[model samples]
Target: MAFQWQVDPEDLFVERYPQMVGTGLPAADVDEVRAAITDMWPDRSGGWVHEWSRLAGRYAAAGSPWRAALAYGWAKFPALADTPKRTALSRQVDQYLLAAPDFDVAFDRIIVDAPYGGGHVAVPVHVLTPPGWSAADPVLLASGGVDSWKMDLHGWFTELALRTGMRVLAFDIPGTGETSMPLSADRGFDVVRALIDHARTLGGGRVAHLGISMGGYFSARSGLAGEVDAAIVLGGPVERSFDPDRTWAYGMRGIVGNALGFDTEPTDTELAQRMSAFTLRQWLDQDRNAPMLVLNGADDVHIPQADTLVFKGRPETEVLLIPGTGHCAVSKFPEALRIMIDWLVASARW
Candidate 1:
């Protein structure tokens, strides 16, 4: 059984439209899509995938591969459970490749093996090196959450490389995007550690991590374990989010369940048990961590403000709660990005 969304499709589309536009989709194109999508599921004629893919086809025909990629990206939005969504993901990757050659920075897509389940899982990574970057320069590992994958982050990655002068390596975290492994709380950090190690080899033995939303969990883990020189977590849940007593807000259960590798939605108890392994509370109690910056919107409803506040007293850690914005400070993203890049440069000495 596929996880069914509890929220209405139209409402979901309206809520996520701004984010799509923020990720580089032209506002007019997205609005056109909004007029076409009457259903959220792929099975319907005017469904989310169908309408978005239709728009993508137009962009591809017009030689606007980046726009086409963004359209296809929305076609597979939220999760990749059904066949149509999976196909959209494939098209999204193809269009992303088509646009890569025209990118401002040098880009390379590399496949590396990361240990998982006592074996190696092939992980696809997008590396962006700045114009003057060298092998001995600093490297930053960047990633997005379950819904927003690596290709969706190209704008941010390119900006980071250009503004900070650090080579940027972007990848989807486990169970999301192109990662071959399913989401396992116990084994997910293996992917992060592998990327950190690979980053070390690419630069002057100094590596940093910047993770958005759920990807921020990995950043916290890497920092807590002293794996990276610095780590930044933006709107990432750290603790209390996995508490069995707490309920998932904003119809997030279905989307998160899909990323957790669940074909059928689990009961609250079952989900809690699985999520228990993801908490970093134990490590937080310990006295060691890399230099870290933790941030989130003060009004973020998806993750409790306490998750960001928990890092306040920790050594070498800075916390910022952007006022009047929502998750990941999406509304004030440019400000957040500036703060993040500045902190990374000074903390990592890039």
Candidate 2:
């Protein structure tokens, strides 16, 4: 099955400051600001630049205000509004994911070690198989949750490996797992890369990578880093790059991460600010990693399913559109695991 990168672009969404965005539209105020910016800089990208000129003359009209608000979302959080570190934002976020009972996790352990010297750290990795592991299988990980575990692990990872041979190695990111590595731009891909290397030493076989939901970030990251033999991305987000101003939402997290600097990794509000400038799209597997499978959910609120499903180059890649699932709805469709097993078999990457 070849990956198809075609779905409605509208389904793609990167939730930014739900509290702020949830606030009534900042359109009215933003229009005034955009007009001022356009009049002064004249040279800019986007349709708003041209529209501003027309709106400038009709500033008195009711519709003019709407036009000016074109860049309100971007302006409200201009990448440097910097979330205050009033308290430990990292700890708060940690409690939300790791400690949150609603997450419903069943994993091997809280911390893990590498085969060689790569610096030890705690990674929340879920192994599909049990007790003693085998070398004939593969390890995989995805960005989203529930579905990845229920859909991929239970469905494909175990059966395929037990029958033909393969295993799944799924993990949450640093900030996501025990290692509270803030999702900084400079350090996003490094997490998957590390996992790939460690998996090779531990499992030692043709690695099959799985990128479900938000895991699309890790999928492309590990792929480009040239570690996995094959990749599977479900609802991959292929935007130009990180939203540059994504840090404004991390209110007071700097004080949280830095205060416990010794207890946690060194991450300041400035780093998060810098991260806003980059997006996950900046990194793509291209041909460096081949034999990829993309499963898309039509209503995935996080990563839209339409962007990276085409067969540009690869060992091979394919996309399957599941209509009922949201970002984490793979479990709803029983065919998901079967689709993946068939893909690996057809690609001969298993």
Candidate 3:
């Protein structure tokens, strides 16, 4: 479908996939995502941007006008209905992505940041190392933010963390959780390298990066820097669906924060145009053919499956089509875990 698909011009870009209608991130990840998003310390963390989301919301209301009705499909602003200045973010994708993998069973907590002065932000990671866990465990950075809000945030991490009893590490990065690094590519890659260094201390080797939705871009950058053993992108986006101005929520946030380094906010539509600046083509240029698993819902409207359809790797590459779900919905589906876990463990590629 072209950027402008329907004739109605009603403003709803795509209908929410039925299977994903009530789905969400894992419970544990949800708490973490909420904490990171809610724990905004203005200026206390110099590099971090505060209230970027609110600015985005206000801009959306002023510019898109139709997004409010679209976002209303998700949550209710029961208490703040009359608050004039508040950002309409309950529907923002980031709000739901970070929670997951109930460590209903407690595990060890360790710090993943460095002690030296060069490190700008200190990030702590939760390490769940089950007994008899191998040293060569696949560690997912576990991004709990907007892009992944609709990805397989919970189902992938929960089953692997709980049932397979594999050694899994979940860390939140700046602009994400705890650590607040600048959005510059160089700085973000540094954090991934540092995370690997931190994991090394805990005896995690042959680390694999699992990138989901928006998380795929960062993971690709990490792979470019040789920080990971292999990478898997579930429901990964290889290309960006053009944002025709105020077409996306985070585009508005980037505008408010002047994230592109401009002094003033970019127009809503301008923000949308820039949203696709990062693409999988740039990330996969090295073509390491690092083991990747790409799964998509046949009905996914937000991110068309074609974006992730191509790859150089032969046997190591795998794709699955869950009949009824979109994005993260497959992970939540009871049988979906069975299919995914069996593949991961069976492949034992990592």
**Candidate that would win on lDDT:** 1
**Candidate 3, overall lDDT?**
0.45
How far does residue 230 in candidate 1 sit from its true spot (Å)? 0.3
lDDT of 2: 0.43
lDDT against the true structure, each candidate:
0.86, 0.43, 0.45
lDDT of 3 by residue, 1-350 (tens): 00111121111112323222334313442233233333222312220122323323453556532232223212211111112212333343232222223333235556665432364567666666555666665544555333222122333465566666566666543333234343334555567677766666555556666555455555645554456756555555555443343233312253223333333445556555555454546655664555656665655555566655654354466666667766644434566556556655754665
lDDT by residue for model 2 (1-350), tens: 00111212111112322212222225554345343442211224322333333332243244333222222222212111122211122222322233223222223433445222244455656555433446654555444421122221222344544443455565654433234444433454566666777677556656767765446656755555556787777555545323433331212233223312223333445444544543544455345556667776666554444445542444555656777765434434346667766776664553
Report how far off residue 267 is in candidate 2 (Å).
Answer: 18
lDDT of 1 by residue, 1-350 (tens): 24656556676665576688898888887888788777777556788889989999999999999989988988888788788988999999999999999999998999878899888899999999889998877899999997888898788878989998999999998988888467777698987899899989988989989999999999998888888988999999889888888776555787788888887878888788888889998888999799999999998878899999999988899999999898899888899999998997784432
The residue ranges of model 3 lying beyond 4 angstroms of the native Cα positions read 1-102, 114-119, 134-140, 147-156, 182-184, 221-226, 241-265, 268-277, 312-315, 330-332
The order by descending lDDT is: 1, 3, 2
- The 10 consecutive residues of candidate 1 with the worst lDDT sum are 1-10
Could you tell which candidate, 1 or 2, scores higher by TM-score? 1
Error of 2 at 201 (Å): 1.7
**Model 1: lDDT to the true structure:** 0.86
Clashes of each: 0, 29, 12
Q: What 10-residue stretch in candidate 2 is worst by lDDT?
A: 1-10
Off by over 4 Å in 2: 1-110, 113-120, 130-133, 141-165, 240-282, 285-287, 310-315, 328-331
Rate residue 177 of model 3 by lDDT.
Answer: 27
